[model samples]
Target: MIGRRGFLKFFGSSIVGLMTLGGYAFGYEPVVRLSIARYQLTPPGWTPGLKLRIVALADFHACTPWMTADRIASICARANDLGGDIIVLLGDYTSGTDFVTGHVDHRVWAAELAALKAPLGVHAIVGNHDWWHDATAQKRGAGPTFSHKALADVGIPVYSNRSARLEKDGYGFWLAGVEDQLALRRSVRWKRQFTTGLDDLSGTLAQVNDVAPVILLAHEPDIFPTVPSRVSLTLSGHTHGGQVRVFGWSPYLPSRYGDRYVYGHIVEENRHIIVSGGLGCSVAPVRVGVPPEIVVIDLG
Candidate 1:
């Protein structure tokens, strides 16, 4: 229905638009933008009149030209300024993608994270990449990954299938962290009996002997469906908002449930989970629509 000139004009415009989008995804969002995402919710079993501020940093995938030690230190400084009641690190500290020119040393990143300050203290959990990158753990088909050791050496408690008790004012609650849900790979040499995860959700929850409500920290959100109502809230990060979401949906979802457990606050059956978009890239170092975020959750 158009002439030659009109068709040429439309084609030129379309090419320019695609180029702009590609530039933003590859250069701008991943490299330059760091956002803060906040949520306020009162979990089902949360104590009345008790407010908690949780600042979370996740999926740093520390590598050159993206998440450098200086950048991590800067992020930590900003988190410290937030004065959060508790600070949590939701793992994947090692490089997620091999597109880096250099890998940031574990000690260097750990030291930068050491600067984080919180009244209830800083807590950490390991992600799939953390386990995958550990040569010793992968070879042996067991844990105590380098990521765990690094965080522990820096005074941050890396909760691998464990629970810790904490309080604010007169209110008390429990914090539990499970091991990575996708820790080991099923390989021929590894034997057919190799397990998928290092996680022991039941064992971790069994450690909670008291009546305090529990807040569970997981690096991946795929465990939400099975999370018991006994847990007041569950916090997670790892999907990175599907890394390159478009129009609130990602064509490439990393989880088994696809976009269902991809990102943001999801409430089901009176239970709650806050899945952070996180601060780094996975698979590849490109982002569109979903920018790197530092998640701040206000809970009661």
Candidate 2:
């Protein structure tokens, strides 16, 4: 039912398209492209006249050819010039994929991150990969994971199930960082959904003893459902914008919630959460429509 000329034409175009797509996914989007995603919001309980600019870097799966120390230092320089009051590292600092030629040392990347500067200081939290890859932490089924120690060594305080109160221009707010929701994840037959983790939302919130609005830094968006109204904003970055989103829809989301919390800002019942696309690749060193990003949030 088809002529040879017509069939050949279709085949040629198909091959070209596929090749273009492959190159974009494997080379361009993953390595060449980086974006800045900005957000402005006014959450409930936010202090009036208190404007906070937060520059968030997430999922820096640093590796040799992909994300080198020089690349990280460059990113930190860009962040430092953003005029943000504070900076937050949203975890997954280590390489998420073994498809790399060399491992970027923990100390190396942490030292590059040390270049980030802000008046309110730098804060951080650990992600699942940070816990899973640490040999001792995985063996102990707990942490002070390698990521935590690396960050601490650079004087960047990691908020592992902790909360810190901060002020900007005499207006106060709280920053709460929960332990990785999927911390110490071990591959087992019976483990799935919300199991084998170290996140303590209740205990972390209880540490907040003031009326100041709360900003929670959770590594994964899976905890967004349980976030209470007391918290003004929740920022997370484990999804990597589904790692290959298309037209704002991600086909293979790692989230249990699927596309529900796949990426970007989501508002439910007046509670808000921003799931950043993050800055590196995982499982595979490839990205298509969802290029890496640095999320900047302006809050009042």
RMSD of each: 1.6, 2.0
Error of 1 at 232 (Å): 0.3
lDDT tens digits, residue span 168-262, model 1: 98988999999999999766766636649888999999999888889999998999999999999999998998888877878788898888888
Which residue pairs of candidate 1 clash? none
Scored by CA lDDT, what does every candidate get? 0.90, 0.90
Give candidate 2 regions above 4 Å deviation. Answer: 187-195
lDDT of 2 by residue, 93-208 (tens): 99999899898999999999998999999999989989888878877677898899999999999998899999888899999999998886655632433448799999999999
lDDT of 1 at 130: 94
Candidate 1: lDDT over CA atoms? 0.90
How much does candidate 1 score in TM-score? 0.95
